[model samples]
Target: MKPLLRVVLVIDALLLLAFGLLFLLTPWTSLYNALQLAQVEPALVGQGFGIALLGLAWLALHASIDGAMTRAVARTVGHVNWLTGVLMLVWLIALRSPSLSAFGQLVGAVVAVVLVLIGLGGVRLAAAVRRREKAQAAGAGATGREQKQAEKAEKQAAQAREAEVYQTEPVTKVSPPVSPATGRRVEPDFTAAHQPGVVTAETRTVETRSTQTHTAADEARDAAADSPGAPRPPFHG
Candidate 1:
């Protein structure tokens, strides 16, 4: 609540406090004689009013300082003040109660005016406080929604940035190995690939010639052995 509103509440508290003290002292002091205030039949009745008024004063005073109770208490006090003023006006002028003095009538009117004014001030303050609280609540809700939307947008952007994209390439079927010069598909031959050339008739002819030469040398050795037997060898005797 604003300082002005708080000040209004403070004034309300002071007025209530003054009235409470006056009522409480009615039985002991000349307040009833001098001001021609209402003659409460029982002293306890006046004291009871005093106590209730004092309680209201304490509430108003606390409402000025306390944020939680400010609006509710101010509103209540405002209503009660206006109603009490209306009641006083009716009793003093319309009913003209015998208990109230002529001087008390003027005092009641003045007190009623003050009450009405103070009541209006309190009511205005309470309304302003209510409006301010509603505005703050609305602002907070909007801010929370905006913050959530921003976070969601940021999360989506991050996901987009971190996402992986894949690229695909077309594949072709493979063909068998082919010789570049021979225009033919070459089947693999592990045995012949290691050799210098392909085997031919010349390889067989060389093998035959080697065998014939070995046979002629063996025959010559046998003829020498037979001739040595005729010339008589030392090992033979």
Candidate 2:
């Protein structure tokens, strides 16, 4: 928890404690007089016991909020505020009786207002605490989700990097050179095919082309010699 939130909680708790003490000590004359519609000391005395019970209940309520009470105590305390609110309303209604003096009615009204204000403040504080708790829980949940997504993304990126490394590395493959004369690719081992005075594939292609050219030239010379009307051609020409 944040320090500021802790401080606010502590302050609210202290305020509740003080209010409880005030409710306990304050006299019940207001309620008693309001009930009788007149100032009656005997009735006041009797009602004091009931008012004391209300105060005890108030104390127990705060103790429950502080986690200082057992589960049963907490459950009972849950009703304390409602009960007190009801009691205050009843006391005020009783004051409406014509028998009550103006002074008694006025006092009763004041007590009712004060009790209501205190209870309301407490209720507001409890709601604030609950709101804060919910907001923190939501924020924590969102952060966890973001962290999980980032981890998944990182894992995918690592796998991709490993895949790239695997593709670029060298692997064994068969290689063949092209034969110019046949226009075919061959993978022959020249060293193993050794023969006395034999030529390599590259040399053989060149020699064969030269021999064909020389044969064509000889054929042309023979045609020229067989032409009877042709004068003897100069050697240079």
Candidate 3:
């Protein structure tokens, strides 16, 4: 509850308590002066008023103690106060008697109107408090939902990143080529032997003839050197 409203409720409770005590203790003088009654018993009227005031005091005190818990009670108290004020005004207008003076009736009417206005103020304050609490609860619920959604989104994004990292391809290492004859790194050669449809029968025949000619020339030279009756060649230093 608001501070100003709380203070007003406390003051109202105190006023009701004081008035109840007054009517209960000094029944004769107070009731006679306030109600202007001659025939009716003052004590009986005082007792009724005292009990009603005490009940109102208790309701007001309960509202002051925990406004949230006793909002309905506070509203009930407000309605009762308004009804009491309206009844008093109605009685003053409908039943005018010699016992009560015009000035006194006017004063009563004014006080009744004041009470009605105060009761309406209290009712309005309670309604406003209830609305504020409802709005705050709704806002808190929305905030919690938003927070949960944000956390879920962050979790999903983290999982996606992990999946992306896991799906990456690995690199393959390659070694340098080595020569077979020299046992060292060398450039590869692509020749007719390695190629398809290049080494034909005509090419093989030409290579065979070249090899036979070289071997025949070497044999002729050896036979000539071994012969005996050949022309003698002059020797020079």
Candidate with the greatest TM-score versus the true structure = 1
**Segments of candidate 1 deviating more than 4 angstroms:** 99-102, 164-237
30-124 per-residue lDDT for model 2 (tens digits):
75344544443455454565466555555554554554332333233334544565576676576455445667667656655655555554445
Kindly list the per-residue Cα lDDT of model 3 for residues 11-95, writing each as its tens digit.
6677678767766755466565666533345577877888889988987887777856456655666676678788877877776
**lDDT, candidates in the order shown:** 0.81, 0.58, 0.73
TM-score, model 1 to reference: 0.66
Which pairs of residues have clashing backbones in candidate 3? Answer: none
Candidate 1 lDDT by residue in tens digits, 1-237: 566777887888998899899878868757677767766778898899999999999998998898788788888988888788887778877888755666777888888877887897789888998999999999999999999999999999877766632223345766778865588987755664435676656656767888898999999977887884556556864
Taking all chains together, the TM-score of candidate 3 against the true structure is 0.60
Q: What ranking emerges by TM-score with the best candidate at the front? A: 1, 3, 2
Error of 3 at 235 (Å): 36
